[model samples]
Target chain A: MRALLVVGGHELRSRLRDGTAPLIALVAPIMLATLFGLALGGDDDPPLKATIGVVDLDGGEFPASVQREALNTDELKGVLTFRQYPDEAAARGAVDGGEAGAALVFPAGFSEGVGAGRGGQVSVMESPESPLAGVVARSMVDRISALVEARTLAVRASLEAGVPADRVQVFVEENGAAGPALSLVGDPVAGGRVDLAVHYGAGMAVMFAFFVVGTTARSLLTERQNGTLDRMRAAPVPLWTALVGKSAVGFGLALVSMCATWLSSVLIFGASWGDPLGVFPLLLAHVFAATAIVMLVASRAKTDAQADGYTLGVAFVFAFLGGSIVPVYNLPEWLRGVSLITPNGWVSAGLSELAGTGAGPSAVLGPIAVVTGIGVVAGALALLGFRKGRFA
Target chain B: MTPALVCEGLVKRYGDKTVVDRVGFHIDEGEAYGLLGPNGAGKTTTISMLVGLLRPDEGSVRVGGIDVDEDPVAAKRLIGYVPQEIALYPELTARENLRYFGRLYGLPRRELTSRIGEVLDLVGLAGRGDDKVDTYSGGMKRRTNIAVALLHRPRLLILDEPTVGVDPQSRVAILDRVEALVGDGMSLLYTSHYMEEVERVCTRVGIIDRGRVVADGTKRELVAELGGTDRVELTLDGDVTAAADKLRVVEGVSEAVVTGSSSIRLLVAGGRHLLPALLAAVGDAGAVTGVEVVEPDLEAAFLHLTGSTLRD
Candidate 1:
């Protein structure tokens, strides 16, 4: 244990003295997180407003009411804006010419058909080039259609019950301006907001945590090349002790980097990580896995350049597949499953759960277990390689 | 007394090639044993096995009477190794490197602190211990390297070409420090291809060639094994043929030959004792302007054993 501590301490001190380690560990993660956060729209920044082109060809109250709801509704205030076109051709032109992301056109007699309790037809024209705004416009149109159908049902029920049609209309009008009769409430999953800063903060942190692999492998190869390994072998310390010591240094650096990124995100960007108890253990497991991976790479490489190349290649592949570069939730279901096979995937899931739902230890336990398993397996392989003199 | 280090039938092979053949040697207590060989003579390989860095395919190494393979940690505690390369963290201060190694050897913090100071002073880097090793000169780095090994105060110090790239002044300083350690009764196994350095620092020498020890003994013993002969050269201003014939009849002269029509070379069993008579004969036959007597050294012994110069 003493030998391990001594060797680990020395390795940490040496790396700390090196300028490149800190640059990769701290600076790069912070920069990437900030860049991604800004690109995704920061919490304090105004949300992007997408323009929806509207063409109410119905020339009636219902179609005009839909347009009015999209234009003057408080919920869609900053989320959407409207450009009224005189005709379907003009609306389609606006969408195709990039004047708006999407265009909503109501066919003639659409409002009369809906008022007579028959289904109305409306066309939503969307540009493939600007999908986000078009998707938002389509959702708004769906809500309006649902409201019109509900009003038709209400009128039909009142007429069947022998209530006066004028009295029913008055009742409908009183509540129609009050918004949707039925509302769906979305509960916070784990009592936390799904902040972009938090998602990107964890992502960039995990991505840069793998950068520690480069530093770790390079240091190992350098020690071998410089004959320090031979020197250490001649010392009283066992080979396993030295290996553990070196691995501990890498693990410690990655852990500190990840924690710093989390803290900085919270302090600098107002990002919340949700529950320290869960986050700390998850970070530990992630760093351990990272360190083991580095050891495995270093053990197989005979030179510094070889180690660097191997580490770089592995880090990039893991980063990409594990959703460090891209969110796994954004990937296809099968791809997300493949991502779960990587340590980074587990880390991403764990961090996302913690940040999104204020998930406690129980929520992150499975991922932590898998990450720790990876560490143990990779560490065993690395030690085997070391004993075989592959590292030398 | 038991030897400080022992290796029996040490054989190390890499696939089909044997890097260190059944080579064996021992360094007794208080003796500085030199392992002399040309480059690629397996000197480093042999020392590596002795220090437990490399395991021999078939052999046994004991340090302070403890088996190195069976109990490497204990064996390593008794040995201080200074590699041919400067095995140090250049970014770390000298004191930091020393303390690190000291702790690796399981030295207590208090003792390690004192030992660091002692080693720094011993290596003449006491005042510059705080400087980063990268900023140090080659000599200083070498000294720090040695200092790290000395931190544990092991029973034996294995220095593998410690002065390979050092300047002459630093070499002298290193040699002086090594001599002092030996004087203080610290056993040493100094490996070098430089014959002069081995002769100057080692009490006994082993000449290795092609992974085998060709000769091993005291410097005098090894030299005496080569028929105890010495060579004398006379640079004459006049005819050297006469000097050659006259020198051939000297009491101790074994063979005399003339070369280049200006000098005569003589081989004698005791060239120093017969130098005066040989000189007189040369002067009588020809005007002897210059005379040089070559005594048998480690180089000559190495040449006699391996049929090649140590440098080659």
Candidate 2:
């Protein structure tokens, strides 16, 4: 145990003493996070806003309740900003010219059809790129449909009792506005500010943590090529101990780096990482898994140069596939399934769950188990190969 | 008495090339043995195999009577190896490097500290021990490297090209320190391509070429076997081959060869004594311009046996 500590201390001091090593390991990740945060605006949740143009070409007046019900609706009031469009061409032009995100068109026969007890449908045009445009277009169509359906139902009731359709429609339109008020249920994901910055920060942490493994593996190769490893073997200590000592140091540094990333997210970007106790241990476990992977790679490399090339190629590929560089949901199902094999994917998934709503202890258990297991297996493989001839 | 290090018929192959052929040698306790060879002559390979860094294809290595193959840890405990390259971490201080290597040798904390200090003093770097190894001169780094090997105070020390690229002053200091260690009853197996260094510091020298020992003995004995004397050469304008044949009939000349188109070289018991007859021989054949007598040293003996210059 003491020997391991001494060896680890030496490794740590060596890393800290080097100028570029610490800068890349510690400072680079944080800087990247801040840059991405300012650019993307926090999390994946977007706050959408749009200006919608409305055109009513109907000449005949509709029932007072129809207009009052349409204007006083709760669903459309908070979601969209309405502007009156004088004609269909004008509304369409407004949508195309970027003056409005979407256009609502009520045809000339819309009021007459509702007044005669026959309901009509409205058409909404929207831009392809705007989330707000989609939302506004759908809401306007649904609200107009609901208003027409109520008048139709009232006329049908009167006709069943042998009353005239015109008289029934006229009578129902007057009372339509008196129907029960529209109310929406409470929002489940409300007040959870969707900041793109948090996602960027989490992604950066996982990528950098994996990078540390690659860097350490390269260092291991260097030690071997330079004869330091052989000199160490000449000592009385078992070679396995030396290998384990190096992996432990790598694990510790990775864990610290992970913590610094999370802290920066909190202190600089205003990210609320939920509970600290849960995240810290999970991060440490994930770091252990990363360390094992590093050892496995370092053991296979015959020289420092080989290790550098192989580690960089492998680490970045795994990182990108696992959603460190891109989100998993945006990828195809097959690609998402492929990410399951990667520890970094599991780590990012685990971090998102910890900070996401509806997360529990079970959410973190899978990543912890996967990463820890990989670490154990990788550590053993490295140790075994190390004893054979890798270090020699 | 058991030898400190012994290898019987050691064979190592890298791919199709046999690097260390069935070579057998031993260094008795407290004896200084040198493995002499030119570049790429497999001297490093032999030392690596003995140090347990490379396993021999077919050989047994016993360090302090412990088989390296069967019990490497036990054998390694008795062996300290300083490789051709300086292995200490450059960013670490000299003292830190020593302490790290000491811990690797499983020295107890108390013993590790004391031994680190002792070895530092022994290598003549006690005052600069606290300075980073990278800041030290090439010689200081070499001294620190040797100190690493000495920390465990093992029974056998194997050094491979220890002073290959160092300055002359550092080379001399390193040789002096190595001599001092061997005199204090430590067995040493030193490998170098420098023939003079072998002649100066080694008690016994083994000349290895093409993965095999071509000759092995004390300097004087090997020189004597190759004929103990100087060589005289005469450059003549005419009939050099017939002049070479006539020189062989001389009383003191042991061997004669037409080394060049116009030159005849003769190995004689006494070059000065044979010079008169060689000049007379050149006169009997043709006009002679230059007649020179040079002493035969290890360099000459190596050239005679290998049919190649020592530098090449």
* lDDT (CA) per prediction: 0.79, 0.74
Tens digits of per-residue lDDT, candidate 1, A292-354, equal 887888888889899888888888888888978765644665887899788999988887677
Residues A1-392 of candidate 2: C-alpha lDDT, one tens digit per residue: 76667667766676677653466567887888778877764533332345677787774454233334444655445444667788989988888887787877778887777656687767888865444554545554665577567766776776787877657655665766333233323321121222456667777777777677666676667778778877876666655555666666666667777778778888887885555665776677777877777777777878888877777776788778887776664456699888878887787677666675436666688788887887789878877776565473
**Candidate 2, pairs of clashing residues:** A42-A195, A42-A196, A42-A197, A43-A195, A43-A196
Model 2 stretches with alpha carbons more than 4 Å out: A19-22, A38-195, A267-282, A296-315, A331-338, A369-389, B109-114, B220-310
Steric overlap count per candidate: 1, 5
Indicate the residue-level lDDT of B44 in model 1.
Answer: 89
Candidate 2 chain B: worst 10 consecutive residues by lDDT? Answer: B303-312
Candidate 2 docking quality: incorrect, acceptable, medium or high: acceptable
- lDDT, residue B104, candidate 1: 80
Cα lDDT tens digits for candidate 1, B27-78: 9999999998888999988998888878789989999999999998889989
Docking model 1 quality class: medium
True contacts kept of each: 0.87, 0.68
| Model 1 / residue B219 / CA error / Å | 3.2
